[model samples]
Target: MDVFDHDAGGISGRRPLVEIEEGAGFPDGLTVDAEGCVWVALWDGGAVRRYTPAGELDRVVTLPTPRTTACAFGGPGLTDLYVTTARTGLASPHPLSGSLLVVPGAGKGLPQPAFEG
Candidate 1:
């Protein structure tokens, strides 16, 4: 968990911004693409969500596994997306909850902006 401290002009300590449902799982991993789109890996929900800068749901990518862990954009020009997942618990009529995934996307992701002084 990482957070920005506006007053300090640097990244601050960990802070809980949003809490997922109990047992539903927390947000696994996240990354901001070159286009400024935020891609988040949803645990248990088995999907990745791409959000616009305005906090709108631009796209949702479903996964074959049930636990989508983290996501990032990589490859030439940052045009490819890579995702990771965890299969901690799966069996006994439960859904598969762990695996890594990838998908082709449009636009290359940009580097994150540095904290202002």
Candidate 2:
């Protein structure tokens, strides 16, 4: 995927970021942590990957289902990673598919900043 810098003039430029391998599932949703690392949900890959700001893969958290769609940090300390998954188009039923999963102590997430615009 490409990361763009937004400015008064609109998107200033694009920088090539993480590229998923051919067989890896598509990236569905993502969130950036307070430390500036990116947590990405891998659709059909059954995992979440944490990448450094420089687009380097740092860690991976595997899930029971292969249809993980999105993730976000919640909980009192914002250190819980809540993930969402899908069950549509699955040839067989998956126990965890279409369920919400939470991983505690994943990492602290930054509060979404307010936009003046």
Candidate 3:
């Protein structure tokens, strides 16, 4: 994936920021944490990975159900992870397929900033 220079008020350019390993499943939903680390959901891989801002793989959270489609941080303290999965094409899906899973104490999420636009 790449991060682009967008502070100029236009689509300036982009530079490589990270590379997902081969066979690590297609990169799906992702969000930046409070620490600027990236949390990505891996489709067909049954896992969520956390990468440092420098693009280094730092942590992985595995799930019993495959086809993880998206993830986000939620909960009162914002230290919980809410994961979404899919079971549309699976011949036999896990019991938790398509259910929302919560990972407690994952990490703090970036606070939403007020839009000035």
Best by TM-score: 2
Worst 10 residues of 1 by lDDT: 91-100
For each candidate in turn, give its C-alpha RMSD to the true structure in angstroms.
5.6, 2.2, 2.2
lDDT of each: 0.68, 0.91, 0.90
Candidate 3: where are CA atoms >4 Å away? 113-117
Winner of 1 and 2 under TM-score: 2
Q: What TM-score would each prediction reach against the true structure?
A: 0.68, 0.91, 0.90
lDDT of 2 by residue, 20-116 (tens): 8977788999999999988999998999999998999998999999999999999988999999999999999588899999999999987876799
- Candidate 3: tens digits of C-alpha lDDT, residues 1-117: 787777657876778878877888888999889999999999988999999988898999999989999999989878999999999899999999999999999999976766999
* Steric clashes per prediction: 5, 0, 0
Per-residue lDDT tens digits for candidate 1, residues 14-62, read 5543344466445778888766667788878777777776566788787
* TM-score (C-alpha) between model 1 and the true structure: 0.68
